[model samples]
Each structure stands twice: as structure tokens, then as C-alpha cells.
Target: MKTGEKVVLAYSGGLDTSVIIPWLKEKYDCEIIAVCIDVGQGEETHAIKKKAISSGASKVYVEDVVEEFVTDYIYPTLKAGAIYEGKYLLGTSFARPLMAKKLVEIAHQEGANVIAHGCTGKGNDQVRFEVSIKALDPSIKIIAPWRIWEIKSREEEITYALKKGIPISITKEKIYSVDKNIWHISHEGGNLENPWNEPKPELFDMVTPPEKAPDVAEYVSIEFEKGIPVKINGEELSPVELIKKANEIASIYGVGIADIVENRLVGMKSRGVYETPGGTLLYTAHKELESLVLDKETLRFKDIVAQKYADLVYNGLWFSQLKESLDAFVDETQKVVTGVVKLKLYKGNIIIAGLSSPYSLYNEELATFGEDKIYDQKDAEGFINLFGLPLKMRAYQMKHFVENQKYNKTTVGGEQ
Candidate 1:
């Protein structure tokens, strides 16, 4: 509430955050501490500090949290098999909480009482950022300029940035709001706003078009230890390296491109095209491994948990008790999920080649169609009868009621 107060801003070196730097300084007469927590934005992060300084930031912190992002955020979500709307892999959804946590840490270290983020009023990121911030440190105040600022549109924001002499990469003609991280890159806005319009070829960044992919299918083996991917094609890799390698391989095959029209947390439907080449590969391989290791009942229940977990992450409840509890259950289910899964990737198709796990529950003798089972075939008659008992009783009751109605109708007309 006071002028000249120190405020920590979540600076992405993007259009919104770049404009926010001078805007916050002009409005509050405060010192702006720009914090860009790097979760694999790649080359764009190289000049973030310099950009922040030029945009009137007193100090800048470009923290590299890629490893933490992969091991903590990405892996847990993957292990739970959480996918939003049965399609989205939740690339942008889970990243916001981690960014909020980093912002709070930087704010505490700098003795700042206020935090600012460039998340627009209409989007879900505003809720994700503010809710996580409140959950972590309720006392710190939040400043969301998109909701309060006089500028009404992206055009206005661009004009303001240009007038202030802030360097930016976005232009109106080529404006597509993009969010990029190690997990995926998402494209929204621009022509993508119209659901009827198909995304142009140039809209894709990470993935090759499926039609343009090679005719030959490529085989890759992914190994998992306790549901976490450890190796690809027999090479043991660090978490970051594994994802990067997966991205490299899968992108070539046009894998992991999702065009979704999903319900936003703020009660609106939005369309986005997501490029998650590596994430798709991991999710597919991990699921195949789970199918091998997990039992019928446990797998069914875990699927229910997966939907709820996806909701929690997508709705910005990453630090909540329910999410923690779900993680515990997922971890328990993943105990026997160590295995290797071979997949054939060809032009956006992930075909399961083979799967092997140390704790596999697939009994070959029982499941085999060629005779020689450890059970008798005649036992199925009793099992089927028991399973259909309720249906049989219901059918008998309906038949009796229909016969009684016919007799009553006949007796009403004449003596029986």
C-alpha cells in the first residue's frame, strides 16, 4: 500500500512481464525485483537479466529450476497419470505453482511484502499463481495488473511498451500467446482462437507434421524404476537429459501434438495447441508399464485417482493436502512399476512393441488361448451364473408382472 515499497515481479522476459516492469515502477513508485525462474525456456532465458535491467528492474534473478521441475513437478504428475480433459498433458497447468513458490522465496529473501505477476484476468494462470502464493505465504500481497490496469488489450500493452522503449518480440501481425518450458510449448490466441480454423503448419514449433514425417517406424526402449523414467534406448540419463532426448526423438515423428478445446478453471472454454513431444512418449511408456505391473482392482482405482489428480493440478491445487495424499497412493501403486517398454513411433502413432517388468502380474498360463491353463473351462458356468443372478431375478419379476396384467385384463371382460 505504500509508495517506494519493494515488489517482486514474476518476469518471463515476455511481452506482458516486460511491460509490467516499468508499469509497476510508474504506478507504485517502487523498486522492481525481476525474478525469472527458468524451467527450461532454453535460449530465450539467456538475455533475461539484461532485459529486466533495461526494463527498469533494480535487481534480477534468473533461477534455473529445470531439474526440480522435472524431478518434482513433472515426474509426480506423470507417475499419477494425470492428464487434463483426457487429452491435455497439463504442461502449463503444473508449472504455475512452482513459479509461485520461487517467487515467494525470492520475495522473502529480498524483504518484499508485495508480489506481481503478468497473468491476465481472463486466463487460468492468474488463479494458479495467486492461490499458490496465498497457500505458501498468506501475508504477502498480490498485484495483478491485467485486472487493474487501464490498458484493455494486448494492442494497448504493446503500444505502452513501445512508448516506454521496452524491447519485445511480439508483434500484432504474428501475435500468438505462447508459454514454453521443458515439458511443452503451448500456442493460443491469434488464429487459434477460432475453433473452426485448423492450426497452420508454421504454428507448430517442436513437432514435425505427421504427414511430413519419415515413412520408416523407429523403435525406442524406455526403462522405468518405480514409475520414473531412467533410461531411453539403453542409455541411463539424468531426468533433464532423458526428457530432452525424448523430445528430440519424438518431435521428429510428429508425436505429442494436441489440439484441445478445454474448460478453463475460470468458467470459460479455450482452445490451445500443445507440443509435448517428450511428455507424450513418457506418459505412453509409463502407462504400458503400469498395465503390466498393476492388478485389475488397483489399476481401476488408480484410474479414478488419476482423473481427480488431473483436476487438482489443472485447478491450481498442487500444494493441497489432497494432492499430497494422491501422490502417496500413486507412489504405493508404482512400487512394482519398474520395467522396460518398447514402443514403435511412426508419424504420431505410438505402437506398443513389447513390455517387461520384474513384478508383472500377467499370468501367461491363465491368459493363454492355447489350452493348458491352470484352471478348468467348465468352472466359468458357475461364475457366469453368479454374476448374472441379479439380471435373471429382475427378468423373472418382469415376466410375472406382465402375465398377471394380461389375466386381470381378460377377467375384467369375462369369467376365467
Candidate 2:
């Protein structure tokens, strides 16, 4: 709260965070260090430093955690096969903890006592940022301006920024809360609030419209080692390059697009349009490879674990003990998940062309219906009887009971 105190802000160079610089300066009268964690925002990070300084930050630090994000956060969620509400790829969910982690690191590096974020009071990100900070460093204080600031809406924030001479890029006409990373781009607010309204063409940046995609189906082959994507079309790539290439290819065919009304952690149903071109492809490839290697029971149980994993990530409990334990189980399943999956991308539909694994459970010899040396036709007789023993006893009991009732029927008056 003192003038000389240092505070590290989770800066995005967006309207909210851009305004937050001066707001913090005026409110707390503290020296602000704007920390922008670049998780593959592409060109969005170009003017971040200049913008932060212009908005009243004493210093700016832009940290690129793209490779760490993909390997640490994205791949773990992918290996667990977690999809929120059966559709959401959790583009915004998983990115929060990693970003918050970086904010804490920067806060410590800057020797700042307080870490600040621009997440609004109504959204899940506030919880995501705060909980993650608490998990890593409990002694560090957090300043959330959205809960304390008098500004009520985006328009109000813009007006406040203009009045304070804080330079910002957002205008009333182009107002949409966007969160972008290596994995996906999420669009919320604006016309997206109305679920019935179709997403405007201009809203689409990462993925094209499905109808506008090429008529010819494009095939892509992905190779996985220990459940992490190792190659694309037989070419090895780094963690960052793999996601980048997959995004490029899948976006061309409009491969990933989901418009859903998801239940937010704030107890409200919020409609969001997500474009996870690369992530969708990777999830499909990884899952297909798992099917080939993992047995039925393990896959089925993993499906249940996947749902819970999704909830933990979505709810911002990524650092919890339960999630760590689930990761252990998920990693055990991925040990044999090394394989290659070929997929056909056509108008946003990912069709599995082929799948193969060294540990594949698909054995043609034992599965053949025709005469096989490994299996005896007569062996099915005893196996079927044993498997259906309960059903056979129940049928016999019902038959005998019906026959006895027919011969010795008792009426309500006790007549037989």
C-alpha cells in the first residue's frame, strides 16, 4: 500500500490489464512491475513492453513459457483425455495455473510482496490465479482490482483509461474478451453472450468455417512416444513446433470449432466459442493410439478418471494432491501408449484412417471366425454355459414355478 512497495501484475496488454497499471498506481501508490507470460500469443506480444510502460508500469517482463506450457500443462491433460462437458477442450482452463505460476516466480524475482491480476470478480480466472498463487507461495499477497475497483463494465474501464491517459487498444465496437495461447483461442462476451446468435465470421481467427473448408480430405499422421506427440507426418518436432504445425494443418480444414454453453465455476452457464485446432487433432491422435495399446478395462476406467481430471483442471485445482495422484494413474496408462495414428481431416470431421502400436491388442489370428489353431469351436459350449449360469438358473426357476402355479392355483377366496 506504500509508494515504494513493488507489485507484480499479470499483464496481457489488453484493455483490463492496460487500465490496471494506472489504477494500481493511483489506488495502492505502489511501483508496478508488469509481467506478461507469453504462452504462444504469436504477434500479440509484439507491443506488450511499450504498452505496459505507456500505461504507467515502472518495469515490464515478458516471459515465454510456450514449450513448458505444452509439455507440462497441455500434454498431461491430453494424456488424461480430459474434455470438459464432453466438448470443451479446456483451452482457457489449463492455461491459468501455468500463467499464475509464472506470475509468482516473477513476483519473487522482483522481490515484490504482492502479485496482482486483472481477472474480473465474476469469472473463473480469479479463482484460478489466486488458488495457484496460494498453492505455490502462501506468504505472497494478491491484489485483485476487479473486486475492489469501482469500474463496473468494459465500457467503463475504457472510459476510465481514457480519462487517466492510459493507452489501450480496445474500443467499444471491437469488444470481446479473448484468451489466446499455444493450445487454443477462446472468445467470450459481446454477441457470444447470446447462445442463439451464430458466431460472426470476423470472430474466427484460428479456424475457418467448416463449410468453407476444402472439399478434398487431408490426411495427417501423428506419432506419439509415451503419450506425448513426437512427430507430425513422420517429421519430428519440438514440443512447441509440434503444436504449431498441428494448429497450422488443422486450422486449414477448420478441424476444431466448439460453440457451447458451459457451466462456469462461478455457478453460471456461459457461452463461449473456442478454436482449438491443434489441440483437437492431438487429442484425437493420442486417444486413437491409446485404444490400440490399452486394454478395454483400463481404457474404460481412464474415461472416468478423465472426467474427474477435467473438473480439477477446470476448477483451478491443478496443484491439488488428487490431481497429482490422478497424473500418476494417467502416466501408468501412457507407458504403452506409444504408437502412430493416421487421420483424415474433412470439413471439421476427424476420421480415423489407421492406427497401429507395438503393444496393440488387436490380434487377427485369435479373432478370426474361421478355423483357427489357437481356438477350438467346441470350447465355446462350456464357456457360454459358465458365463450364463445365473441366467440359466433364473430361467429354470421361472419355468418350474409357472408350471406348479398352473396346477395348484389359489384364488383370493382360497379355492384351488
Candidate 3:
């Protein structure tokens, strides 16, 4: 906590981070090393560096982490089928750990023991960032401005920025806090605070409105290898390029938009609108492929794992042992989940058109409605009897007990 010590900050060149650069200098009198981990938010690196330096940062590092994010964070979560609260695709949740890891790496490189972030005390990112940093390096000091700083409310922060002569694009009227990456974009705050308020059309960035989507349904085929999307419409692409292509195609037809009132890790309910164009397509295709290949029991158990995995990611326990174990389970299940799934995208609907896989467990001979050599119709009679034995026995026991009660009542009445 000494003055003039180098402190690495997780910078975004946004309003909160822009203000933090000067505030850190004024309060701690420490040298601020601004590090922006780019996870495909589409930020201009040169502009961010310029702004960071202008705002009193001694040095700047804009680390490009898009490819690592997709292959490491996103694909694993996708393969696990982890959807937070059945709606959030975990766009912001999974991105934070990677960003924090990069921050810690830079902090080590700079020989700084302290790290800072722009995450607020009220939201989930603070937990995500701090926890991941602690997990990575327990010795790094974390400075969370929102928890300790006196300047509260975005309005007050704006005033402080003006007083400090810092450049910020956010205004009081358009104060929606947004988080964007290649996987998804999330919009919170502003009027979205109210659950009943319909999200304004202008708030959406990645997806077209379902009503505004094209009249013609477009068919797209996605091929997967071991549960990771590898191709689109018969064309092979790198992980990053595949996601971009999926986003481009699915966004046009308004594929992935989720408005959710979810339970935050901080014991509060929050409303957020998420746009995950390509992610939606990928998730749908991967699930269909799993259905084609995985057995009923493994698929059912994976659903359980999916919910727990989603909770761990949402609660910022990405480095926890349970999550690592679950990842192993998910990976084992995905070994046979290689296939091509064709889907029809129209007006925000993803309907399965066709599914093909060499590892498919679905057998037409056993499942056929007409004549089938492998399956005997009479076999179901014995199977049903075995499957429903407990129910049948319980029903019979109830019937006999009722008749015995009636007989006992009649005998008692006659004796009276």
C-alpha cells in the first residue's frame, strides 16, 4: 500500500475505468498500469491506449484474448450446456475469469503486487474478478473502487469525471451499463431496472427484432467435432471465425435475444437483456447432436451437471474443484457428440431440420412405427409391466385396504 508503487488495473477505457485512472493517481499517488484484456468486445486498441495514457496511466497493455476466450472458456461452457437460470448464456460470467487471469499475468509481468478493477459492489463481476484473481495468485492485492470509493452513483461519477477533466462518452440520460464480447452483449441499468418495462427496440445491438426478421426461413447447417462447432454451412472455419460467421448469419434473422429477471450471486434479483446471436445457434446445434449420439441416462445426468455448472460459472467459482470435475464429466460425454445438425432459423426460432452423426445412438430399426426386425411389439408389454410394477402394486394395496375397512365397518355395525 506504499505510494509510487505500480498498480495494474483491469481497464476498459469506459467511463468507470476512465475515471479510475485519475482517482487511483490522486488517492494512492501510485503509478497506474492500465491493462485492457480484449475478449472480442471490438474496442479500438489505439484509442484505448491513448485515452488511458491521457487519463494519467503510466503504461497501457491491450491484450488480445479473443481466440483463447473462445477455445478455452466459451467452448467448454458450450459443451457443458451451462445456461445460467435457463436463460443467460453466461456471456459475462465466463469472460471475467479469463480477463482477471490476464490482469494477474500483467501484474506479475509489471512486478506489481496490487490489481484494481472497475466492477461495482452491487453486481456480479466484482466477485468474478476478485475470486479469479485470488485463485490465481493469493498474494495480489485487489482494490475494488466501487466498494471503497466515496463517489457513488453514476451521476456522481460523471461529476467527478468532469471535475477531473477526464473524457467520458456516457451521459446521465443514456446510462445503460453494457458488456459486450464476441459471444454475446448484455444491457443492464437505465430503464431495464424495472422487470415489467418492455425493452426498448433501440437497446438491442446484436440481433434484429423477431418482428423485423425476414419472411423467408433460412436453413443453416452447423457441424460439430466432439461437441465444438467447427463448420457452418459446409465451410470449415477457425473457432473465432466460426463464431463470427454464426453471429453474422443468426443475427440477421433475430435468433438470440433473452430478457431475464435472474437471481444474482449477491442475494438480489436483477433484470438484463442479453443478445447472443451465434451462441444461440451453436447451443441449439450442439444439443441436437448430443441427442443424436448420447444415451438417455448420460444425457439426463448431463442436464443436472449443466445446471450446477451454470451456477458455478454465475457465482464466480470457475477455478473451484467441483467445476473442474464437472468439466471432465462433460468432456467424457462429449467424446461421441460429433455430428452435423441442420436448423431452420426464422424470426427468432431455431427449429431442427436434420441431424446426422457417425456416433448416433438413434436406431430406426428399433424405433420404427411400422415393421421392424429388431423390436418385438409384445416386448413392450413385459417392459411396461416391469417399469410400472411399483405403481400397480401400490394401487392394488390401496384397493384391498379400502375393501377391508368397509368389511370392518359392516361387522362393527352388526355387532352394535
Candidate 4:
């Protein structure tokens, strides 16, 4: 690549990305266009722009992608009932593709051949960012400073930043690696790296302590249209808006706190403390809705697909065709899942308040235990007889064969 070619750097106003802007400029002697995709980072974007400029970037592109992040990425996973390995909601996984896409866009716009991110060599973010970039624009030269550069650790990077006179936002004392988005905020590293250590309560941003949650139960209604959340408290919203609204409501109830030890794609178990209060609430409500609308066989079959779907999303195969096909199946099943789920949130528990669906298959009179002429009690006798026909026939044949071994269907030890 040309030495002076423009490059788009994925910039967070944090220590790693802040230091990366100047590092990119000096190492390659190229124009650095810092691209920050706002996936609900919950801060003023302009400040990040200023930070990027001070760190030696020629330009800054802070794109508002919360809507896209929620609708295209978060909502689809919600509809699929995707929880990675039945625990993780994949807060960080969902944001990476959208950010990488934006990076590719800015790189092409700047006529830049190179793109870089602050993802560490040891983490999953590098895989997420690089895979997405290669999938979107394979021609773009990927520069991963963490993988190649001599910055051995975060401490070294901090010292480098100080020596270069670059203003850094992170401190040595508070060094928990964090990724924030509208869906959730995840905390890893530091004390959390050890499974024996309980997550620090102060690490939470979106939730109150479950113990501090309301003593009395709080109720809320969510309306779904074809398995997708469309209305919250009767206010219609886009997918993104619905999740954001849910996030606000659920956070108040101290919902969506997940501390999991999960296996990474690179084959190592890692621990993360996650806060996805809205996602937690949404997941519970949607499953309840499906239980009402779906038949027993369909629900069981969908579960098998759900596992695969979860794997696909977690493994960053969102753009794959298999995921598309599974999504189609999920969408078709969701046609009858249009309804409202009222949930009673008390402490850390989500109790079902009520559920009503337009396509509800509940036949109360038939299911009732009361005596009815239409339902014959003796009918079970014949039904059970038919159901056990094969077993009965085998038993009868064996009984006769055992009794008359010499006249058996086949000679026993040549005795016939």
C-alpha cells in the first residue's frame, strides 16, 4: 500500500483507540480518519470528535447507528430467541458488524486503502471486526496494531500515550475493559477475569441492585406483530425505538443482569459481567407469547432451530445464507405470535401477569377437568390399547414361542 494513503481508524474516545489515532499517523505517515459508530454509547459524539482530532487524526466520523444496531442486529436476534449457549445475549457481538461496516464505508469514502481497530489480539473483537471487513470489502487493507505492534500490554500502551503527550481517558486503577451499546454494557478483565471473584456492584450502569428493586411488583405490556416487538404501552415504535424504550423501562426494574463464563470462538473460556435489562425482559415476554401461539410439536421443532440460530449469531455468521433460511422459518412461525404479554417484575424475577393472543389455541372447555358427556372416560381404554398394539403383539408371540420351544418359528439350536 502507498505510504501516504488515507486510513480509517475505528476510534473510541477510550485509551486504546485514542492512542491508536496518533500511532496510525506516525507509523504509516498516513491521514487518519477516525470512524466511531455510536451503538448507544450514551455520550456526546462531538466530544469524541474533539478527542480524535487532539490525538492526531485528520478527520472524525461519528455515525449515529443506534437505530441500525437495534433493528437490524438486536431485534433479529430477539426474534430468533438467541442466547449464546443459553446464557449470553451477545451484547458486544451484535455491535461489531455494524461498526466494521461503517469503517468500510468511511475507508472507501476517504479513498483509503487501510482500516484499523483497537481490538486486542487475545479478544473476540478482532475476529468480529476483521471477518466483517473481509466479508464486506476484502480488498481493504486491514491494520491490526495490537496483533503486530510492540505494545505488550495496556500498561505499556498507557506509558506510550503519556510519553507521546496524547491525552488518555483511561486510568490504571480503573482498567476493566468495557463495551457499551443500547442493548447492553459488558465488563471484562481486571478482577472479573477470575471466576472466583464476584463482579463489583459499582460496575453496573443500567440497573439497580436486584435487592434494591421495587418491593411491590411492577407490570408492563409488550405487543408483538409477527414475533417482532412493535408497541410498548400502546405506543407504536420502530424496532430500534422499541428496544430503547424497553431498555429504559427494564433498567428501572433491575432487569437483564447476566454473569456468565462462556467459551469463546477461539476455544477458551472467558467470563463477562453483562447488563442487558431490556433484552432480558424482551426475551421472557416473547417466549411466553410463543408458548401460547405455537403448538407443542412446532415449539419443540423450533427449539432445535433456535440453538443453531443462536450459534450462527454468536459466531458472527449473521450475513450467511443458513441464518437467512432459519430466519424465514422463524418469521413464518411468528405470524400467529401477535399478542400482548403482561409481566410482573418483582425483585429479580419475571412473573407472568397475563397473556392474550389473537391466535390463541386454548380450548378452555375441552381442557377443563369437569365432567362432560362429549368426553368419554372409557375412550382412554381403547386409545391406550391401540397405542400399545405393537408391544402387545410382541408379548403374545414371545409367550407362545417360550411355551412351545420345539414348535417355534425357527429351530432353537437345531432342535426343530
Worst 10 residues of 1 by lDDT: 41-50
**Candidate 3 C-alpha error for residue 63, in Å:** 0.4
Scored by CA lDDT, what does every candidate get?
Answer: 0.95, 0.92, 0.95, 0.86
**In model 1, how large is the Cα lDDT of residue 256?**
95
Q: Which ranges of candidate 4 are over 4 A from the true structure?
A: 372-378, 390-416
Residue-wise lDDT of candidate 3 within 1-416, one digit each (tens)? 99999999999998899999988998999999999999999999999999999999999999999999999999999999999999999999999999999999999899999999999999999999999999999999999999999988999999999998988899999999999999999999999998889999999899999999999999999999998999999999999999999999999999999999999999999999999999999999999899999989999999999999999999999999999999999999999989899999999999999999999888988888889888878888999999999999999999999999999999999999
The alpha-carbon RMSD values of the candidates against the true structure, listed in the order shown, are 1.2, 1.8, 1.0, 2.9
TM-score of structure candidate 2:
0.96
For model 4, residues 221-245, the per-residue Cα lDDT tens digits are 9999888888888899887778888
Q: What's the lDDT of the predicted structure labeled candidate 2?
A: 0.92
Error of 1 at 347 (Å): 0.8
Lowest lDDT 10-residue stretch of candidate 2: 407-416
User: What root-mean-square deviation over C-alphas does model 4 reach?
Assistant: 2.9
**Which prediction has more favorable lDDT, 2 or 4?**
2
**Off by more than 4 A, model 1:** 44-46
Give the per-residue lDDT digits (tens) of candidate 1, residues 211-262: 9999999999999999999999999999999999999999999899999999
TM per model? Answer: 0.98, 0.96, 0.98, 0.92
Candidate 2 C-alpha lDDT tens digits along 85-198:
988998888989999899888888888989999999999999999999999999999999999989999999989988988776778888899998888999999988998899
- TM-score of candidate 1 on Cα atoms, chains taken together: 0.98
User: Weakest 10 consecutive residues, lDDT, candidate 4?
Assistant: 407-416
CA lDDT, candidate 3, residue 225: 93
